[model samples]
Target: MIQWIIPLAFICAGIIAGLIGEKVIFKKLKTFVTEKEVPGSDIIFQALHRMTFVWFVLAGFFWAILGSPVRPDIANAFQKILTIIFLYSVTLVLARLTSGFVNLLVRRTEGVPTSLLSNLAKIAVLILGTLILLQTVGVQITPIVTTLGIGGLAVGLALQDTLANLFSGFYLVISQQVRTGDYVKLDDGNQGYITDINWRNTTIREISNNVIIVPNSKLASAIFTNYHLPAKEITLTLNVGVSYDSDLELVERVTVEVAKEVMQEIAPELIANEPYMRFHTFNDFSIDYTLYMRVSEFFDQRIGKHLLVKKLHKRYHQEGIQIPFPIRDINLHGN
Candidate 1:
């Protein structure tokens, strides 16, 4: 009972001293570190504070027990337990530091996804820590290694599609084919701007404001168009029909002028040079013509075309040019 009392007193004193030191000393240290703008200094200070507390407790225990006529076996067991605890604390600190370092490195690089890199770093650290813990416990790793290999194989076979998508997602990021914020159109008729590219799927926001999740496997397999890359310019065409009696040259000129004015009115930055109207096809009831123009962005292409058509309609009315509606000729013979 006397021996236990000394050890308990030492532990209590160490705890009180640690609490006072952390509150008084380390709090000031934190302010200095923050003022210096040193990266990951807060984590370093936290780890140091914990280690100092641990050291104080260990020192107190050793001082209290060293003079006692303790059993050699009991002393060795206690030492081993203490060593294991210390190693585990060190491992935790190392893992945290490594994670912070990897995150910093990831931020410095361009086009690398931080989420994926951070996850990988964390997993690597956890695996290393697990191995260390197993070794510390005197457990043979041969059986564990064999079991993991077999289990991994089973999992691979069972989750082939999921794995494919995961790998495909990585490839997509590395290949730089489609990145976040790019407008894309898939073969399945899904068109949207990419919001996030994750390990399993890419999230897109459609023009209608609905979110679409596309699996990486499907994105890899399908033919898709990225409007941002290669070029930002998109060509827009407007098809119009007029009465055959309308003068072809006059109609073409009027349509081109209308397109130019519409582009200037709605999207002056999108307009590329001037528009051209071609008398394309002679339809059953009207002369079909096409107006071609270029816009700065794919999103504006549709709206600009619509505005051009509206302007053309108004202009044609002012010019007294007739836009013919569809006319079907039906003949019936009775015998």
Candidate 2:
């Protein structure tokens, strides 16, 4: 009983210290960092949050183990266990820090995807930590390394498709072709916004609120149009025809004015380039031409076309511009 007293006292002291540190010191530090708006403070706080209490408690246990008058072998085993636990906790912290930094870097660049890169960073840290842990525990690592090397080859051969997708995902990210958040239409007619690129597949969220899971290999090889690339603002073409009796100059002017109105509503910043039309055909009843307008993005084209058509129809009616219906002459021959 006397021998246990010191250990118990140490444990109690540790618990009290952990409570005070967490509730007082950590709370003040968190408040200070938040108020200051320090860069990387969030990441540091996240890595350390709730972990400081565990550290203090672990310290108490370590001291208790050291001071206890227990059997030599038992004390040694306890020490080894504590050491392993502490090392693993350190490893976890490192992994979080690495992942946090990776995500921060990607966000700043605004080009690459975050999930896959952050996951890879965390995995790398964890793997290195595991190797260090095994070495610290006096485990033989040479044989394990050799076995993994051989087994990896076998696994690679077995998982060809999986590896292909994984590599393809990397290529897509590094090449900056198919990025997250870009609106893309695949050659197969599936169109959506790229939500994420993961280890095996790319996730696309369609406007219909449905998700499309495209395998990385297929997406990499497919011919897809990225409306987000070359710029988000895109050119929208609306073809209209006027009656042959209508004024051609007035037609172009009115069409352009209507296009400018729609463009102003949809993308006012892009109003520098005035809308224009080209008369392309002399049809049987009406002259056909295409109206070229600019909109902010691919999806905006829909609303843009809708507004242009409605407003043009109204304005044309007000101006007495006749949009003639298609008239085909029927020859009645007794055959």
Candidate 3:
């Protein structure tokens, strides 16, 4: 009964100490998280909430058991159990921290997602922790490692498609050719903003809000144009035709004025230093020329075209600039 009393007291004391430490650490962490507002503060707070008191209690429990008089075999078994729990807890904590850090990084980087990498990191941590635990408890892992090595080649062959996609995803991530928020067009006429690249597919969101999922392996091999690269700004040309009788100088002046107005009102930042037109062709109907302007990106070109056409037509109407249509003259001879 006396022996039992001492052990019971020690165990209770350990639990109480753990609870106290938990509250104290949590309070401090809360303050720090609130004050600092770091990227992974929530993850750190949760980790501390679980680990701080649990570790203290585990330590106290171990101390209590060691201090009590017990058989050597029982003591050894208890110590092994404690060691396994400690290892498991440490692995869990590390995995969470790693995943949190990765999530933070994902937010900072473009075109990178965290789910796949975070899960992979956690799995790796658990596998390593399991192996270490097994070794600690007198289980040999060399045989298991050898077996995995031998089977890896067969597994690789069986999962050829899956492996290809996985490697392609890795390559896409490293290349940075296509990135989030950038507009891209595939050779087959599919165009959209790249949203994410996961283990098997890359997600692109089109202007219509529809998502296009292309296999990572295919995306890696496909020839595509990235409009956001080199620069986000793009040049757009609008072909216009004025009647041959109209004055070319007046036409250029009116067109340039309207373009400058559009630039200032619609896409001031996107337009190039100058808006100009070139008289390039003479047809049977009207003189053909091309109006050149710049836009912020692919999407902006649509708005650019709309505004320029509307304003140019209105201004042309006011200035009496004649836009001609194709006309054919039919003549007949009588004998």
Candidate 4:
């Protein structure tokens, strides 16, 4: 019991000191620094917390080794304490540096790249820490490294498709072919605006406000149309039919004028150029005409087309132009 007393006292003292430090020292430090408008109070708090952990670890180490057969001399004990403190200091510095590095990388890139870089940094730090701990515990890591290499090869082979998608996601970010907020049409006929590009998939928000998650593997392999790239301007064509009795020149002039007017009224900024009406085909019921116009954006085409059609209907009715309806004539032979 007497032998255990010194060790127990050391531990009790450390705990009491830590409590006091947290309550008194830390509080005073916070107040002083805050009153002075210091810039790094948060960092100081983090360092203090780390130092408290160091003290606790050191106290336990001393308690465990005090009565051992290999008990160190006073000078040796002091040296050992210094070494422990040094190691703790080194670890703290390394941790802070690694954290700063991760934050810097995260701030520099966005989307998939930032995620990848941050994850990679964390994994590297963990691996380095494990290696250092192993070495400290007198374990040789050569065999472990070799085994990990072999295991990694097998894992890579097993997860080839997954890795491919990951790499493809990175490629997409680097190439800037598609990004959030771009309107895209997938090969599978899904059309939507890109909401997010993540590690494994891209999220798309449809015009109906439904969200769709598309795997990077499928996106990388599929042919997709990005409507927001190259330019936002797009050509939209509306097919209309008028009765054959309507004058061709009058039809073209009225259609063009109506389209331009509607575009100007609804979306004045969307009209990239003057609208034109073209005679496309002669159908069974009426003459098919195409109204071609350039809009500032693909989405505007929908609204522009709707408004133009409504205006065209009103104008055609006012001008007495007949929009022919399909009719089938049947002749029955009397038996």
Candidates in order have lDDT scores of 0.77, 0.90, 0.84, 0.74
In candidate 2, position 103 carries an lDDT of 81
User: What lDDT does candidate 4 reach at residue 134?
Assistant: 61
Pick by TM-score: 1 or 3, better one: 3
Candidate rank order under lDDT: 2, 3, 1, 4
Instruction: List clashing residue pairs in candidate 1.
Output: none
Best by TM-score: 2
lDDT of 1 by residue, 35-98 (tens): 9999879757754657667766766666556544588788777766766777776777777677
C-alpha positional error of residue 255 in candidate 1 after TM-score superposition, expressed in Å: 2.4
lDDT of 3 by residue, 1-335 (tens): 68767777778887888887777767876887778877677877765566777787788778878878889899889988888888889888887877777766766775345355666677788888889889989989999999998899899999999899888887877687776678999989999998877778889999999999999899999999999898788877999999999999999999999988888876787555688999999988989999988777889788888999899889999999999988888999999
TM agreement with the true structure for every prediction? 0.59, 0.91, 0.77, 0.58
Clashes of 2: 0
Positional deviation of 65 in candidate 4, in angstroms?
Answer: 21
Residue range 101-186, candidate 4, lDDT tens digits: 55454445532234444444555766777677667656799999999999999999999987887787777766878876678999
| Model 2 misplaced regions, further than 4 Å | 328-335
User: For residues 39-106, could you state the per-residue lDDT of candidate 2 as single tens digits?
Assistant: 89899888877778888888999899989998989999998998888899899999999999888887
Give each model's clash number.
0, 0, 0, 0
Predicted structure with the largest lDDT when compared to the true one = 2
Give the C-alpha miss distance for residue 173 in model 4, angstroms.
2.2
Please report how far candidate 1 places residue 99 from its true position, in Å.
9.8
- Candidates arranged by TM-score, highest first: 2, 3, 1, 4
Better of 1 and 4 by lDDT: 1
lDDT: worst 10-residue window of model 4 = 110-119
- In model 1, the Cα lDDT at residue 251 comes to 91
What lDDT is reached at residue 242 by model 2?
Answer: 94
